[model samples]
Target: MASRGVGAALAIAAAGLLAASALGKGWISAGSASVGLMGGEVCRGGKCKTLELPEKDGWRTTGTVAFAAALGAAGLGLVAGIMGLARKRSKVPAVLTLVAALAALGGGIAFILVAPGKGVMEHLAWGAYCGVGGGVFAVVGAILLMRAAGAGPSYAVGMPGTANPAARTLMLAETAKVSGPEAKTMAPGMAMAPQVQAPRPSKGAPAMVPPCPKCHGPLQFAGQFNAWYCPRCQSYLQV
Candidate 1:
């Protein structure tokens, strides 16, 4: 999913860069002159040029640079998304997404700074749109990658130690320990008595036991109210 999203984003970015480059080239080819007409009067030529306007001599080079940067960032994002989906065990893709997002932002800023006066606002608008969109895609991809690696919201409860199977088994064993006349008689002179095992279910009985909600672990059968309990985590649940 992340891979597909990144690929789509890359395609959009590539198209945007191509359009911007084409527009910039067209502006240069049309003779770097400004023309304005107000009522019957006409204003034209170098008198309309402003200091804030990008220099004509190097504008194409700058546009090319901006386009290249945007392409590079989008390429990186695509690679990161592919890695994230394929590996499913590494955080490298998440880090790569963040880097790609920053690169896209930088490229957008540079493009805005070097754009010509006539379409400067339009250029900046497109750049801002691409920057923001790329950034959002990167963040969402990073989050999905983290989730795929099992390092995010799913395990936010705690680490693996307490949820270990062996640990849970031990806890269950402890909880199953018994201490009555029948337990002592079963072991005779033993210092500690063995647990009183619950009767095995009949052939037609349910095979899977329910789990406790709090710890999401298997629960032990408790007869009276058709309930189950997680001895390890001390959680109760309806059977």
Candidate 2:
């Protein structure tokens, strides 16, 4: 993704430079005539006779400014790409690359607007190229940002079904719930019969007890503990 962004920035910058060059050529053709007060040539007789150029709206100024802006954006993208390569954990570089690409696109648009009428098609073509390049940078930068923020791809480590530290803790808790002693206590009645029984008959008394120590419910002691046990409270007491 970072590579894509860098590529886009470079493309946009190149297109802007190309458009600016064409505009500069037109400006040069228009300004090659008579010397003005500033010692620069002025447009005369449909041509500029003197080599000196006007300060503003001159072919040289237009081309130089446009190319400079494009190159600056390209430089920024290059720097961002280098930083991204160096700093694996940082998203700053990726963001800078996207910004650079956008700048290049903007410069291209400006060049298209300032270029001569006959060169409109060429300017539009350059603008489109820059737009596409900037779009690529933006997308790549976004992906990089997502990845840096831990929102892309899973690198979880821990239990087979879990992710990070918290997930591991929860997994262990759930496993304990399923396989611990509480699970055994809730098993089928067949496994609990011997453990839960009625008491033996007291001398000259009823064989079954009616009062439980824990809850005053009927008591039983089938045989395991040899003591009175409550079926309701599951408590046991020595006979």
Which ranges of candidate 1 are over 4 A from the true structure?
A: 1-65, 83-87, 122-128, 147-194, 198-239
**Full-model lDDT for every candidate:** 0.45, 0.45
Judge candidate 2 at residue 1 and give its lDDT.
41
lDDT tens digits by residue: candidate 1, 71-188: 5555555656566545546666556655655555555455555555665554333335544465555556655555555533322223223444455554444334322223233223
Q: What TM-score does each of the candidates earn?
A: 0.42, 0.36
Per-residue lDDT of model 2, residues 1-239, tens digit only? 45434433443443344343323333212223222111334455676544543344453354345455445545554555444445344565455545654554555455444444464453233334444454355435534543543422333332354445466665556445434656434323422323433344554244656576456777664332234556786655444
What C-alpha lDDT does candidate 1 achieve relative to the native structure? 0.45
Clashes of each: 0, 14
Cα error of candidate 1 at position 213, Å: 26
Which candidate ranks first by TM-score, i.e. highest?
Answer: 1
In model 1, the clashing pairs are none
Worst 10 residues of 1 by lDDT: 34-43
